[model samples]
Target: MKKRSMAVMAAFALAAAGCSGGSGGANPSSGGAKPADSAPAKTEAPAKQVTLSYALWDKNQVPAMEEIIKKFKEKQPNIDVKIELTPSGKEYWQKMETAAIGGTLPDVLWMNGPNIVKYASNGMLMAIGDQVKASGLDLKNYPESLVNLYTVGGKLYGIPKDFDTVGMWYNKKMFDEAGVKYPDGNWDWNAVVEAAKKLTNPGKGVWGIAADMNSQEAYYNTIIQAGGGVISDDKKKSGYDSPEAIAGLKFWTDLIHVHKVSPTLAQMTDTTPIKLFESGKVAMLWAGSWNAIEFAKNEFTKDKVDVAALPKQKQQGVVIHGLANVISAKTKNPKEAWTFVSFLGSKEAAEILAKTGTVIPAFNGTQTTWVKSTPQFNLQVYIDMLSYSKPYPVSKDTSKWNNLETEYFKKAWTGELKIEDAAKQVATKMNEFLAQEK
Candidate 1:
């Protein structure tokens, strides 16, 4: 799931005052004991009904997921899929970790770039490479980066479900009010800074931008554009200490600390940057494609905002990442689970997701449907960005360095440490974590 999805889910819960995902629930029909790992009997006896648990995090996509499930059910009537929702990213992963340790992981579950290496390396996940080959599934149907993402040590553990890219989501009204030209494909970092200065109105309690701690949507893109990587290609070294990486980190801090065109850490914490942008208090927000659902649903932004290609620095760039569906190595119902996971990765499933506008289905050629799903906005900007976008950076253990990023960067964001200092500290600690990863 995209980072923004969790924040959006929290907002949705607050509005509804509420909150499946897997921590393992017993199936009375299948008994609480493990079943033998044998392929379905060749004769297909009785077609006994079997229930498989499917875990995912985004509540906003549940409707589309259910539609896909309906399609799956139509094909396999004897197989029942139980949708388990874990609305919070933190809680979802915690539960998944516990379930993994207990060998009670759900039959099928959502997987992301950050955790793929950890789970797959530990032998907690079942590689679907053989299954894909046997099924004649085209690996070319998905983006090569995403296919490579789920591939660990020559084994494929998951299949791409959906993908996302970052863009500059801006309020046109604010741009017009400030007499600043709207952002476009040609705009660069300097252009944005100049425009932001004109758009900022301190007396009106408005900011030109919201530079928060969202790496996927913000710094990561800039860092790569600046010719720095988060990790070495071998995934054994840190790049945060490099000059290019430091430049990327400084770009954001300068906006808040030096330029004074963005909200401070405290101000942002009071009300999220998303709320500020939606409420017309911030002129622009660096957001991912996952935000389309939330922005379209929110009354304040539905008709007021639009997106453009992210401004370039040294080069035009953005980060692309996607979610995948994987089956547990310990699943009691491997055949049924693989069936569901296979369906999840099918073009039929992609079309269902596309029509709903829930995500950019990873299946090749389906993005056009998603692009047309929201005609009001230039949704094509996201697809257009693919030409120059880089895969989101990750290592065997992305969360280790990712966590340190928030920890050390907070000092710079809060004005307690220089951007260079924070970045150097992050680099030092991140290197330690990278070294520890086998």
Candidate 2:
């Protein structure tokens, strides 16, 4: 498996031809800011005719996302923005490394949370704090934690485009057929466990739930709700071994062993839990809002698949991942690229994303339609997630522990290691990695 950012491998076809710009980065058609209110029309210089290449990973999102680019073009007509999608997670990084090694990266790429910290520290990203301030963006509404995620050593590098949380994806038909009541937003983990038992029918090839050992999908909520965190405050240690965290990890591990309502982690490794849910092999899946588009487009139809808020653990909460639009440090047209990058984080862009149901926008209050638009299930889960959401863990070396999750988590999931033991091992390894960092 290629150990790299997911967005790195999505580089696709070259973008449509954009406005012509002089080889030297100067724009002949560059122009100005429009008059505001009754003030004399400001004769701003013409906007630069710059073409910026944007790299991303999701190919399925291209069609619906064109509208946003079109909107950006309407305002910044002189700026030609191209979208490039990398093919796979591994290849994305390989190709990006080739570019960076050659000093020819695209003007923009969807920066990853972990990558942002790494690149910014290496001076591979341009400071975006000034640009964000000039764009009149309300970063505060986006979530303070997210702002911190994209920031490294006190400087911002990207804008939080959209932040998403996980929820319990349940099969309504399964519930109805089993004569089990549907789970509401207020459902607790115990309630979910009970529902899982009632829904599981191994003889009929249906399991109550699919519990994959995914940090983002499975254990983050449990860890947080248990009042423990995946990493220590200073990023120098793992908190997985904490009393609260051990309790959390045990909850999921117990489901596979004691409860017997979900698949074992090994079973999930062969095929993801989501695939089980999609194939009608499972009754419930803890999924993130990012799945809304894929779930909506699922062949099973929206009726068979509905979403509800994640069940409460020791407390109410979910792990939220924020997708950000960041400019490449290598861009020659910083001004023009900034214009497009800022546009990507705007309210209009958020609306575009929400309307497409591709993602929950980070802009203030732009996700209302997205949540309500899908009528098959109450969309309130997206909103409900906000109150208890926390940013993804950040570090100078995120990969140090990113993969260790499943590696150590499987020990408990497989019954070889108690949750306490697994947590201790994970913490030990994570602390070693942190100690090695400057």
Per lDDT, the best of the predicted structures is 1
lDDT of 2 by residue, 367-437 (tens): 67678656676667777776667656656667657657657777778898887887888888888988977
- Listed per candidate, the RMSD to the true structure in angstroms reads 9.7, 8.9
The Cα RMSD in angstroms, rounded to one decimal, for candidate 2 relative to the true structure is 8.9
Using TM-score as the measure, the top candidate is 1
lDDT of 2 at 330: 75
lDDT of each: 0.79, 0.70
User: How much RMSD separates candidate 1 from the native structure?
Assistant: 9.7
Segments of candidate 1 deviating more than 4 angstroms:
1-46
Residue-pair clashes, model 2: 17
Task: Quote the lDDT for 350 in model 1.
Answer: 85
lDDT of 1 by residue, 84-143 (tens): 999766678877876776678899998887778777876779998888877656666776
